[model samples]
Target: MWFVKVHQNVKFHARETTALRTWVPGLGGAGPRLVAADPALLAVVVTAVEGRPLHGAVLTGAEEEAVFRSLGVLAGRIHAGPPSPSPTAVAPVTRADRYAKVDRHLEAARPHLAPGDEEHVRAVVEQAVVLEPLPLVVTHGDFQIRNILLAAGGSLRVVDFERSAPQPVVRDLVRLPDHFDGREDLRRAFFDGYGRLFTALEQAHLATEAVLDAVSGIGYGTAHGDPELVERGRRILARSRAGTLCPAPTPPAGGNPS
Candidate 1:
């Protein structure tokens, strides 16, 4: 059992124990025994695992591919599971909600944006709003390196599902390639695995925007009263407008049509 001290009134012990009980069965893990819980503090006792996090920037070519493969398979399993009956009752954040939050941030920063950049942001926002909604599935609300734990023998585990909730299956896919920018090879591996479980244009669209929205949020958040990240977001938005940023279908062997 491991004890983690957290902010006041935020206890991880009970929740971790409960989560382990609810989610760890048949996974070859013992129940997480809660050692303590306090209303005025936050902490949890969990079965500690010995391993370092898989960082995108530090991974070798092969390692990177492996990580993407793992992510894809894991995401498929999670999404295929039954939907959370009461998603809204949980700490769920929808794509629209995230988009709106980012929009508000962009609006507040409009005074600092270049004219072209401002228009680009507006376009992306509009496009996102017009996309059709896909069927909701369980999502790992936050699926980033910091939350994925890599173990020996190529086995892995997903930690920190506090934000988990029912969302479009595509929402889960978006986290993959976006997390590793410019790595098309790794992206393909992830997509290949994802394709085995899910095959549909609508699902692909949901995943596509989820990634764009995530990237947009990153760029916008980094701007945070600054102009640099906002400028980056503008460029990304423009790319999206040109049809270059949307997820592309695998081209035929001869090559894609102009």
Candidate 2:
């Protein structure tokens, strides 16, 4: 069975897919085997992944934990791999790049928000913009549950690498929200699977990044009349401000953060 992904008139998407055909194999089966890319038709053919999306299951407690761990391990491996060429190949997402994204989207999101939400978003962006650059990796760019597919026996593969890039792995890690009811286990399991202890401040910076994504979603939802998406984005921003998912455990002075 073959999976055919057609980009139609989306030149950018076509090119990104073409590039991903070359990149994913280096990850050792983390992604589908790219069969062929038809640039003229703006399409790609790949071996079909015969599995259900991880999101489509009512997983047991242990199964859920295993999935989260798999996510972390997958993330760790992707971070170790090289970047994909989207518009163009770049080093990594710099703080300036992230700040610019905030500047562009925060205004678009302001009209959809409650009082001071815009300022709150900006403050979060500011905090992240001032921190030292984290280590760079080939981030999956969008590591959401929907992007992951789990085959029988818990084997998994991630799809949609068009947005992958060289950026802070936290950019992907922040995909796991801590505020969802009964999601603490998922969060810890992800980190444990990642096998790298992150500093509290780093996690906080990622929280800030997540808010920026929410702000962008809010703007889209408002323009598209999707109240559910708007509400979801609003909830994420609100929880972030309330410190629901933004952890900043203070480290001792002059001591290395784990």
Best by TM-score: 2
lDDT tens digits by residue: candidate 2, 1-258 = 888887746644643564465567776655778777776787778777657888657899888988887887888877776544445443355778777877678677888788878889878876776777776667777888878989888977888866666677678855567333357666666666776657766776778777887888788788888776688688888888777765643333453447
TM-score, candidate 1, is: 0.68
Runs in model 2 lying further than 4 Å from the true structure = 8-11, 83-91, 178-182, 225-228, 248-257
lDDT of 2: 0.71
Q: Candidate 2: minimum summed lDDT over ten consecutive residues — where?
A: 248-257
Deviation in Å, model 2, residue 82 alpha carbon: 3.1
Across 1-258, the per-residue lDDT of candidate 1 in tens digits comes to 484545332323333333444443323421133345454555554556545576434767887778777777777766665555332244344656767666666555565555565566555656667676666766665666666777776656666644556667666554444443566677666755554533445544644455355345545655566444455455455555454554553532454222
For all candidates in order, the CA lDDT equals: 0.54, 0.71
